[model samples]
Every structure is written in C-alpha cells, then in structure tokens.
Target: MQQRAAITLALASLLAIGLSGCGASEAVETSPTSTSGQGSTTYPLTIDNCGTQTVVTAPPQRVVSLDQDSTEILLSLGLADHLVGTASWTDPVLDSLAAANSGVPRLSDNAPSYEVVLGTDPDFVTASFGRHFAQGGVASRERFAETGIGSYLSPTDCDNGISINGGGTRTHALTIDALYEEITELGAIFDVPDRAATLIDGLKTRAAAATEGVDFAGATVAFWFADTKTPYMAGGLSAAGLLAKTVDLDNVFSSSPEDWPATTWEAVADRDPHVLVLGDLQRDRFPGDRLDDKISFLESDPLTQTIDAVRNKRYIVLHGAELNPSIRFVDGLEKIQSWLREHKDEL
Candidate 1:
C-alpha cells in the first residue's frame, strides 16, 4: 500500500462526499463510439472516470502524464504526440516507453507540484493513483474542473463504492480486464477507438499464450514488495495475485483485505511460500527498497531462512513497473509462467 498522508485525505474526502466504499461500476463491455475507417476524429466524449464525470470536448492536445503506467498507455495507443509532459516516480525509465515518446519533456522526477504541472499548460492530466488529486497535491478534482482541465484516474485506484475491512476502501483489485477497460476508455476520450480495440486484441492474445498449458496447481507464491520493517505484501486482489491465478500458483496472501497490505514477518513465515517474487525497486528514488537487501534479509535472518523458499533460494526478481496495473501486466504473467516452467522441479 502507498503509505502517504495524501491517500488518507483522499479517503476522508470520499467519506465526506457520502461515497460508500463497497462496490464498483461494471466494466466497459463495448468500445467507445468512433468514425471507423474514415480516419476522421470523433469527440465531445464524456466518461465516468473513477466516479468523476469527465467530459472531453475534443482530443486533448497537450496531455500531462503523472505516472509511468499512464505514460505507457498513452504511448501504446500511438498518442505520444498528445503528451507534452511525463513524470517518473518509483519505476526507472523504461526503454520502450522512453523510445516511443523520445523528446517529450519530463515535468518532474516524481509527482510534480501543482504549480509545475500547471506550468506545462496541459489540457488533460492522467494519473494511476487517486491521491494525485489530493488537496495538498494537485488540489482536488473540482479544482481542475474549474480550470477547464480534465483529469482521469486508473479505475484500479478507485474505491468510491468498494468496501474493506476497517470501514475504508481497499485498492480496487487489479486484473487484465481492468487494464483493457482503461485502454478502451482512454481511446474513446482521444478519438482512437479502433486503435484501442486493436491493442486490447493483441494484449488478450498475449495473455492467452502466456497461460497455455501451464500447470502451477501445487505451487504457492509470495510477491514481496517492501521490507520487514512493515513488509508490504501483494494481496490476492492485486495485479500480482491475478497473474498468480492465471499461472495457477496460489497466492499465499490471498486472504488479506487490502490489495497491498502491511504484513507480519511471522505470518509470512507461517505461510512459507514456495517461491518469493521480489519487486526490484529503484533504490536511489526509493531509498531502502532494494531487491538485494530483501534477498540478504531472507537468507541471513534466522527465522526467515528456515522457510522452504529461503533455504532453497527460490526467488524471482520482478521490475516494480511490471507488477503495477498496466499494459505490461501480460508481460509479467508471461515471465512468471516461463520461470515456473523452467523451474518446475522447485515446486
């Protein structure tokens, strides 16, 4: 989970607005309307994005991406021309994403201040996290609306109607369907319905190929994102969990309520996963979140070393970006299955 004051404020705002965090809207089953085969653009699009009503009167010409996942989406749809700025936070510069939008200016190394974002004169802003619109962050959704600037959040970050254990909303479970819905929705807003459809079809094919003939019935996996200080675990409702399901590996933390929850080392020890998937975060940007550090702890700690996975050194290093709710989710799934096939005996 993202431990930040901004998220706390966002949850409080949701409650203040009488949004009960218990359910989610149905997935978008149809592609947005388009002037197919004509090459002409369609517009005046209106979408209910993360419970916020967003209307784009025309294609957004100057877009600002506040997250890597959103940046990848814009580029994947051949909408790089519309992006005027992009930001980087947890993930490093992905070669494919960087090459797609070669000269697009980077507005910030991380989430930019509201002033810096406004300096770019963006007509639209897209983010993967809901806290991007917090009061002390980019202000609020209404504030952006007042300025005639449209904003969008990834549905996986939305909890408007989804309920959780402690009277708050857990991060919406990330899945392949959620990724497709986001791409399709963005396509409609940008007048590129056909492109979105084509992309989704390709992604679906990739996903299918990744899971074909894979049998992971007896294996159990744990996606460890952070350290023992307050070990951040990827719960069953997360993208990682969904990928585990696709590969047939049981997620050890599937019972946790939060998508990314602070877990106890003792609990992890008890579960004793068969494989440990390490999230290789950028240490410079995220100080202590190094993959090596986690490995060392698992191997050296007396208690942790006793676990079967630790003793066997069965670890899979995953780029943090691949694990996020993004287009690369399929790629992540493929990697996991391929690894399992190569090391089937480990199970």
Candidate 2:
C-alpha cells in the first residue's frame, strides 16, 4: 500500500507540473482518451498528434505503417486497401486480418529506411513507438512534413513521456482508452470515423465480457516481457499493469515508474509473485525473446527456480503485441481472466 501511495503521489506531481504552464490554454492536456467525434472526416483535416500538428489534405490513399501495431489497427479499420507498405513486425499478423494483410506489401521485417518507405509513394505514415521517429528511426515527424507527407505517432508513446532510448517510462498508468483514441484519430485521418467507433465499441464490449464475474484480487503477479540476465518486467504504467488491475491482480512491481524496467532476478524472486505472465514474443532480438527459452531459464536458474510462480508452474503466456499498448491488449486481458478463473482453486 505504501508503494502504491508513493506512485500515486508521483503521478499527481507530474500532472500538476504539466498543467502548471504559463497559461492553461497553452498547456497540452493529455487526456487518457481522445475527444474526436464519430462523424466522417472532412478534407484538409488537422490533427494535433503527440505535440505535432499533422495536416491531412485528404483521406490517405497510400499509407505506410512503421510498426505491426499500427498496421494491425489500419487493417482492422478495413484500410488495407489504402496501406501501400508496412514494416517492423514482431509477430505474425492476427489471423482475422490475414487476408487483408496479404494484399499489402511488407516493407521490411524490421524498420525500413526512409528512402525505402518513400519509394512506395506514400502520402501518410503511422508508427506505434516514438523510437520510429527518433535518430535511428525512419525519419522524424518534421522531416516527413518537410517532404509534404503527414505522419502520426501513437499517443501512448508521447502522452506517457516514453523515451526513445529504451522501453521508456510512464508517469501514470495506461488504459485501453488510449488505444480507443488512436483508433478514433486514425479513423478520422482516413475518413472512416464510423469504423473507428465500431472498433472501440466492440473492444469495450469484449473487455467487459472478459472481466465479468472475474476477480483475482490480492493475487500478486509479475509480467516478464523479455531478456533473462536483466529481465524487462512490467511496471505500473503499462498495458500489463492495466491487465493486472482489470482482473484485480496486484502487480508485484507496480511501484516502478518505468514501463518495462530492467531488473535483477533477485529483485523479482524477492517479491515472489504468485503468478507469472510471460510474453511469448516471436522476435529474435534478445536471448529470452522465445517462450521456450524463458521457461527453460525460469526452471533452471537457481534464483528464479525457487520462486513461488516458477515452483508452482503458474504461468499465463501472451503474444508479444498483447503486452504492448495496442488493440491486442484486450486479448491479453481476456486470456489472463480466463487463466485466473480456471486456476482459482490452485492459487
């Protein structure tokens, strides 16, 4: 309780500082959700996305998404016809979206170069992480604008102050509302506001159904995203935290402010989480990216082997994208809810 109180206070202080600008109007209010309407978007739409004003002259007919999350969202909106190219994938495309996704071109299995993206003659671009617009990314928003192309960075990245250096940090806990806002804004940008509204409504319904009559209150849990030597555990202000909170599961590392903090196995073992939510990432970027590798390490490592979760083999595995702030987050939430219901007696 003391740790949670401190995190609350820290978030309050950050909010106060952000709103205490020279003038209230000058301050950018980072609401958890967007206020975009459900009406169709008019031509020459200007969206204030992540502190940058992106002006779309018309519905983008040739869009290039820099990440899998953004690409999936676009496909969900039935805009695959408009998506000319995509890159930076971590998992296979969602089965429901496979047919639509097949029609689009994969720019690269990873981050594509600026020239390569532009080669598709794209009029608009979208990314799920700030790193895509950073120094090593395809190009900055300013550079895209300079080339007469509009771009959007997911609000989750900028609104939460996620650093481009690593997994980044968050001052406040994130929720599904952020994903709703992204869908709404994207719908408007693509002149498909109704589609966005429908998507948000469906997600809300699914989330409600997932949590209905489910309560795992007081059951401490931990989310291990990747890495074995220095594991990136989920903190309070992330989608994993949201999943834990929704199911009333107490996140062991909720006190940390970083979205995915690199912590020692000793720290995780000390907390001794009752359940372990492992990310089954398909990416081969790191040593522990695979689910089998993660399980092998947990059962073999002396420090982790004795942990309550490892000893009991209480684990819930989710796809890589589900751990990140995106439409797939609901998938993670539902899976966790189901697991808790099935293992109620065991826990």
Candidate of highest TM-score: 2
Please, what's the RMSD in Å of model 1? 9.0
How do the residues 1-347 of candidate 2 rate in per-residue lDDT, one tens digit apiece? 00000111111211121111111001112222222332345545666666676556567778899999999888887777788999988788888888879999999988999999999988888998888788877888778877777787887776534442224557667767677778778867766655666676667767777789888868999999999989999998777888888888899999987778899999999999999999998888888999999999999999999899999999999988998888887787788878877899888
Q: Taking the tens digit of each residue's C-alpha lDDT, what string does model 1 give over 113-194?
A: 8888889888888887766776456557677677777887777666663223213456545556667677767766677655
Model 2 global lDDT (CA atoms, 0 to 1): 0.77
What does the lDDT come to for candidate 1? Answer: 0.69
User: Which residue pairs show collisions in model 2?
Assistant: none
How far in Å is the alpha carbon of 334 misplaced in model 2?
Answer: 1.6
Name the best candidate (by lDDT).
2
TM-score of each candidate? 0.83, 0.86
Q: Which portions of model 2 miss their true places by more than 4 Å?
A: 1-39, 160-168
